[model samples]
Target: MKEKIIETSIELFDRKGFKETSVQEIVEAMGVTKGAFYYYFKSKEELLRDICLTYIEDLLQQQERILRDENKDCTTKLYEIVYMLIHNIRTRRKSARIFFREMRHLHEEHLQEIKAKRRAFRENYQKLIEEGIAEGEFKQTHTPHMVTFGILGITNWSYYWFNPDGEISEEKLAEIYVDLILNGIKNREGK
Candidate 1:
């Protein structure tokens, strides 16, 4: 029942902005009573908090696993991480949309918590970029922090327009992004 409410709320919240969605709408979508919702969550904001926490935390865990794999090189790890984000966007499009778009509706306390987790995710990317630089795989011209944001910005923004049913597969799109990151789009005259 709790999971039902959360899933239903995510659907509603994705379609209707969090501020626009009401408890009545959530319960109606789930065919449950308000009392049922109250039994699981104290308020609509609480449900939103749960959704944000679950989404970010799950991504963090996946990233941590990738980071822990000692066998993969920095370049390979970077590709896999980008693939993970793109694959997630492909698989969980609605949740991804809500995670990125509806977060501002959270109250200050919940917002802070989400921000901390988000920072952790960003740090993971920064550390990976730093490793790539240390190994001479990536150019040190840019700061790892800046490079991390660039990679994240490119991959994360795909949620807004990446078509799951489009002709391009997620794997191909990920490869394109990884290639773009590794090699700029400039055409070499002699090559």
Candidate 2:
């Protein structure tokens, strides 16, 4: 019952922005009474927070697996991380939209918790870039901090337009993005 509410709420929240989605609408969609919702979540915002936590927690677990792998190099891990994010968008599009677009609606305490987890993910990403640079696999031209944000900026923005079933597979997109990060678009002959 709790899971159903979360899933149904995600659908409604995805279609109708968080502010626009009402607790009434959530219960109505599930053919349950408000008491049922109140039983599981204190408020609509709490439900949103749960959705955010579920999404980020799942990502963090996947990231830990990739980050801790002994056989993969920084470059491969980087691609896998980016690919994981893109693949998640396909799998969790509603959760992705709510996590990114509707997070502003979360309350202060919940927002802080979410931010901390986000920082953890960012730190791991930065760690990868720093490792790549230290190992001479990536160029030393950019700061790992900014480079992490840059990679995130590029990949995160894909939720707005990326199509998993489009001509470009998620794997290809990851490769293309990693290539762009590793090798700039400017032609050598132009210089």
Candidate 3:
């Protein structure tokens, strides 16, 4: 029941925006009563916080695994990480929308928690870029953190525009990102 409520809330929040979604709508959609929602969540804010926490926690765990994978080279692992994010967005589009677009609605403490998790994800990628630099796989000309944020900004914001039914496959999109970051946009003939 709790899972259904949360899942329903995610759909509502994603489609209607967090502020636009209300308890009545949720209960009506779920065919449940107000008492049921209060039984599991003290308030809508609490439920929103829970959703954000769950989303960020899952992302953190996935990133930890990506960093810890020893079987793949740094380059392959980096591309895989981006591909994983693209796939996640495609399948979990609503959750991704709520997580990224509705985070500002959380209270201060809850906001801090989500922000910390977001930082961890960025830091993990920055660490990977640093490792690549050390291995001579990436250029030392640019700051790793900036590059990491740039890559994240491009890939992460794709939730706003990316279409699962589009022509581009997740792997191809990831490769394009990887190539853009590593080789850059300049034409070889000019140089």
Candidate 4:
């Protein structure tokens, strides 16, 4: 029942902005009463909070796992992390949209919590970039912080236009992104 409510809410919230989606509409979409929703989530805001937490926390865990794999180099780890982001965007398309787009609807406290988790996620990627630099795999021409944001900006923004059914597969998209990150799009031969 809880999962049903969360899933239904995600669909609705993704289709209609979180501020626009009402508890009544969510319950009706689930074919349940408000009591059913209240039994699990105190209010629609609480549901949104849960959705935000669940999405970021899950990504944090996945990021930690990739970082913990000692067998892989920083470059491989970075590639895997990019792939993970693209894969998550592909699999949890709706949830990813809501997680990134509807976060403004969360209360101040919940917003802070989500922001902290998001910061940790971004920091973890920055650390990976730092590691890559230390290992001589990545150029130190740019600051790690800037590079981290560049990587994230490229991959995260894909949620807005990435079409899973389009010409490029997620794997290919990850490769293209990783290539663009590692090797700039400049026609070096012309130089």
Candidate 5:
């Protein structure tokens, strides 16, 4: 019952912005009573916070697996990280949208926690870029923090318009991002 409400709420929140979605609408859409909703979540804000936390937690877990694995090189792990992000966006589009779009709706206290997790996630990627630079795999011209943020922005922003059902698969899309990040946008005269 709790899972159903959260899943339905995520769909509603994505379709209708968080501010536009009401407790009544959530319960009505799920055909659950107010008592049931309150039993699972204290308030709409709490539910929103749960949604945000769940996303950040899941992302961090996946990143940890990639980062902590010594078997993969920095470049391969970087590619896998981007691939996982793209796969998450495609497989969990509603959750992805709510995560990126409605996070600002969270209150200050919850916002701080969410921001901390976000920073940790970004830092993981930053460390990857720094490792690549250290290993001489990536160009040293750019700062790791800047490259991390750029990679994040490019990948996360795809949620706004990316259609997973389109011709391109997540792996291919990841390759495109990896290529862009490693090689950059400028055209080279020779291969």
Candidate 6:
């Protein structure tokens, strides 16, 4: 029941935006009474917070697993993370959209918690870039801090229009994106 409510809310919130989505609308969509909603979630805001937490917590867990794998170096781990996020579009599009586009509605306290988890995600990527540099797999020309943001910007914004089923597969998209970042699009050794 709780999962159904959350799933319905995500679909509605994705289509109508969080501020526009009302408790009445959510309950109506779920064919349940407000009491049922109140039983699982204290308030609409609490439900939004749960949505935010669920999205970021799953990401952090997946990230931790990738970060822990000693078999893959920083570069490989970077690809895995990028592919992981892009691949999520197929399964978690609405939730991802909400987490990215609709999170401003969360209360200040809830906002802070989500922000911290988001920061951890960014910091972990930054650490991966730093590791790549230290291992001489990546160049020293760019700062990992900015590079991390650059890479993140690419992966994060991909949610807007990247089609995993399009001509470019998600795997290919990740490869191209990571490749572009690792190796600039410039034509070296110009004739």
Candidate RMSDs in Å, in order, are 1.2, 1.0, 1.1, 0.9, 1.3, 0.9
Cα misplacement distance, residue 105 of candidate 1 (Å): 1.1
Clashing pairs in 5: none
Candidate 2 residues lying further than 4 Å off, grouped into runs, are: 189-191
Q: Write the per-residue lDDT of candidate 3 for residues 1-191, one digit (tens) a residue.
A: 99999999999999899999999999999998999999999999999999988987888888788889888777987898888888887667888889988999998999998999999989999999999999888888999989998999988898888886799887788889889878888999986
The lDDT for every candidate, in the order shown, is 0.90, 0.93, 0.89, 0.92, 0.92, 0.92
Clashes of each: 0, 0, 0, 0, 0, 0
Candidate 3 whole-model C-alpha lDDT, 0 to 1: 0.89
Candidate 4 segments whose C-alpha is farther than 4 A from its true place: none
TM-scores vs. true structure, each candidate: 0.96, 0.97, 0.96, 0.97, 0.96, 0.97
| 59-118: candidate 6 lDDT, tens digit per residue | 999988999999998889999999999998888888988999988988899999999999
**Tens-digit lDDT track for model 5 on 112-135?**
999999999999999898898999
Worst 10 residues of 4 by lDDT: 87-96
Model 5 residue runs over 4 Å out of place are none
In model 2, which residue pairs have backbone atoms overlapping below 3 Å?
Answer: none
- lDDT of candidate 2 over 45-122, digit per residue (tens): 999999999999999999999999999999999999999998987889889889999999988999999999999999
Shift of residue 171 alpha carbon in model 2, Å: 0.8
lDDT of 4 at 98: 93
Is 4 or 5 the stronger prediction by TM-score? 4
For residue 171, give model 4's deviation from the true position in Å.
Answer: 1.0
Please give the lDDT score for candidate 4: 0.92
Report the C-alpha displacement of residue 138, candidate 6, in angstroms. 0.8
